[model samples]
Target: MLDKTKRDWWRSVVVYQIYPKSFQDTTGSGTGDLRGIIQRLDYLAQLGIDLIWLSPVFASPQVDNGYDISDYRAIDPMFGSMEDMRELIAQGKKRGIGIMMDLVLNHSSDQHPWFLQASSSRDNPYHDYYVWRDGMPDSPPNDMQAAFGGSAWTWVPQVGQYYFHQFVPQQPDLNWENPALRREIYDMILWWMEQGVEGFRLDVIDQIAKEPDRYITSNGPRLHEFLRELSRETFQKGCLVTVGEAWGADLQRAKQYSAPDGSELSMVFQFEQMMLDQQPGKEKWDLVPLPFVKMKASFARWQQGLHGCGWNSLFLDNHDLPRIVSRWGDDGAYRVQSAKLLATMLHGMQGTPYIYQGEELGMTNVRLPIQDYQDVEIQNFYQKRLGDGYPQEEIMNSIYAKGRDNARTPMQWDDSPNAGFTVGTPWLKVNPNYTAINAQSQLADPDSVFHYYRKLIALRKQYPVFVEGDFALLEAEHPRLFVYRRAWQGEELLVVCNFGGEATPWQLTQEWEDAQVLLSNYPQHPGDLRPWEAKIFYRKNGAAGES
Candidate 1:
């Protein structure tokens, strides 16, 4: 059995994700580069960040942004050279922060050397590096729909076969069944680690072992076996953190993946809570109001399910999702309070929290026209909806609410021409609210959302309750109040948040009446929670005390 006393370093630290293209642009190329990140190390260090999970900067065709990797060993010139990456890693280590690269292994860009050779002819040595099926020029082997909309199989007339792709056709799925391909992937991973990368965030990792012919796209038969083999060859050799993006994972599967036995992964990113705002059994574009009751139940289930064995990755915003403040909280009148409330509730949970770039500044969604959106997924869906005779207004409304580009706007650094992100035109337009919500303004204000998030990060590191505590939900049936308790050893923390725009009365228990106020959005509790108020009270030995 593994020793239970020594905890991993990742459990107590917070992770900040940086989408490179939109973070900062120092080259005036309208795109962010590695030098831009190196220049901002002091800002991240001041934010109490312990790790940075950077999105893909590898050599790519930019079809799916950087996710469509064309070369695994080279850095794209758009971002920078290998020397710039080395400097960023070295600089981050100086500030006690580590780098975690996003690993896209499920597929590679069609322009990749392997794919180019595989499509040249069926007799080539690299013919088996990708998933291909022999069929007529117009027909495919299976009736499967691609994640973006149309057919999953793309006809390759050069080889007289159809290649499978879960995403866009430009990204062909790699054949993991071939040991030679797996060996190549392992070698590339080790090479990056040798360059001083501390960890990896596996993108769409669950689909690597997919059995496409049988319509099995996730958690396939050889999933665990392949994961264990990958772990033994790479992550097990050092104290490295590996998180798999498993959107299809549930509580039971998360336990197996994060069993702490050093077999599969460190943790899994489950999307149960992210789907709560969508209609049941419908696509994400078919939206619905935020299901408060169902959202609470999902959170409690994961918190209690993965308490002792598996771990969870707490996040509400990412490169592929809309900003949480705009999607769930009020981003108009009570933006600051609601943003802090959302952060407090998430940080008080039992997991390692992740803060996406501009999220701490309460960045909101953009209402740009269809032509202004740059994401491939959004463009594909918009065209499909238009072809289906849907009104332009209806399609745009969904885009405004859930489009991936909502989170891809340039970082709002100041009230400059391009929000201080670029000297030239930005790759994507900056949010217009940058005039009121920018890092320059927030850094000067003590009561800003950025400082609130910093305090939350500090609390997680200073208190054991945030890491090893057992979570229990309070007032589970309440519609407007989100209440929970975290207890560890003799320390207890009561976290309450009013998830509405009106003042709500909450009856505080006698055990928490005089508890030390560890943190709160408001100055003091006046027998009622103000609009979007959030408070965290600390107690010890059944009595109030300093925390």
Candidate 2:
């Protein structure tokens, strides 16, 4: 039997996400591999993170950067052998860290064996494994659009039908209605759990129950039923953590998925706050200035909504998003201070905080010419917009602001060539400012962003108030400040942050007048918060269960 205490380990620990392709390269192939991650185990351990959410490393054609899996069980040769993955799991465990694999269950690469067989013949046993519909050659079943671009349906000559794909045509959606397909996916998940994987990060899991005919891609009718079955068959057998990437989940839907009843998932990745900077009813490319008031309201809603009923996953950036420092924080003069401020605001919240690779070093976005971009999403957008008669300058400007390549740049380990990520040529161009922003320099500086993150993570583990406290947003309408209070039994934590580059006037509440400073980005606390300043104050009450 799985120890209940051991299974809940994820709640209090920080998770570090590694984009394998850009983490570190050991084979001189200019691509990071499992062996490269194995070599960096000690660095992660030293940083005090308890989990590593490794992105998809399964065998693939690299069409969507491993999100399109050709084989669920095999490790891609570019990454390394299965043995290397085993070593990573074993080594991580030795350092008191867990491994969480990224599973792409919503779709599979067209090159997958099941898809090949399904598309080959109408009478094939695997035909029902994927979503297919009859359509005329000149027209698809509907006018639905794929996530990347173009039509969502592709005509297969042999089967005389169109297959549904939510992403690029190379990735065909799976049919969850098929019993056999569900059984196969369950068995594959069990196989990995048996191999000692501690958890899973489900990619686009909310889209699995999509109704292609109805043009509904998320929050479909049978989504919960399917998720409950997934839990009963695999995760429920142990204390395994499961996080679903749910872009459509609201406060109520989030409750159903992550309720303490343990029916569906441990938590969910909601994009409500992430979308605050984008134009409403438009794509991410339609950027707008960050709305501080809306952003705080969104954060307050999630924090209060999921306080006791469900859970929340706190994060500022990820592989699919641009660097937070560049997007919201000051990335130039106050880069270090702003990065630490953002971390304080996020980590002080009540959730399992996720740290994306290179975020700890205060990384910023990179600017490259359109032709130099390597991301399929970017390339597709550029072509589609150009064909639509949009100005080339306008399209390129949006790319600079929101391209995925911003976060996929190679991790800067030192000031050496290629940011010390690869001895050979890099798969993506290294950011030009790596010399001053690399990890080597940060590790030696006690007041660097890297060390600040280490302190914040340690504080989370040290205080129970951080885990079980009640969150109340302060100064909810403040233009350039994000302030909140976390209170637990007989204790309170006041977190103050200045989100702008200019000094902001602020004053502490009367109750926290004598609170001790727990952590601060600046050495001295003036009457007003300095540019991008962040501070956390701690107070203790003598009465039991006191507010």
lDDT, model 1, position 114:
97
Residue 3 local lDDT, model 2: 38
Per-residue lDDT, model 2, residue 251, is 93
Return model 2's CA RMSD, one decimal: 1.4
Weakest 10 consecutive residues, lDDT, candidate 2? Answer: 1-10
Tens-place lDDT per residue, model 2, 1-547, is 1132675666787899999999999999999999999999998887888889999999999999999999999999999999999999999988888899999999999999999999999999999999999989989999999989999999998989999999999999999999899999999999999888988999999999999989999999999999999999999987888899999999999999999888999999999999988899999999999999999999999999999999899998899999999999989999999999999999999989999999999999999987778899999999999999999999998999899999999999999999999999999999999999999999999999999999998999898899889899999988988999998888889999998978888888787889999999999745889999999999897654775
Q: How high is each candidate's TM-score?
A: 0.97, 0.98
Clashes of 2: 0
Q: Runs in model 2 with CA error above 4 Å?
A: 1-7
Worst 10 residues of 1 by lDDT: 1-10
Best by TM-score: 2
lDDT of each: 0.91, 0.93
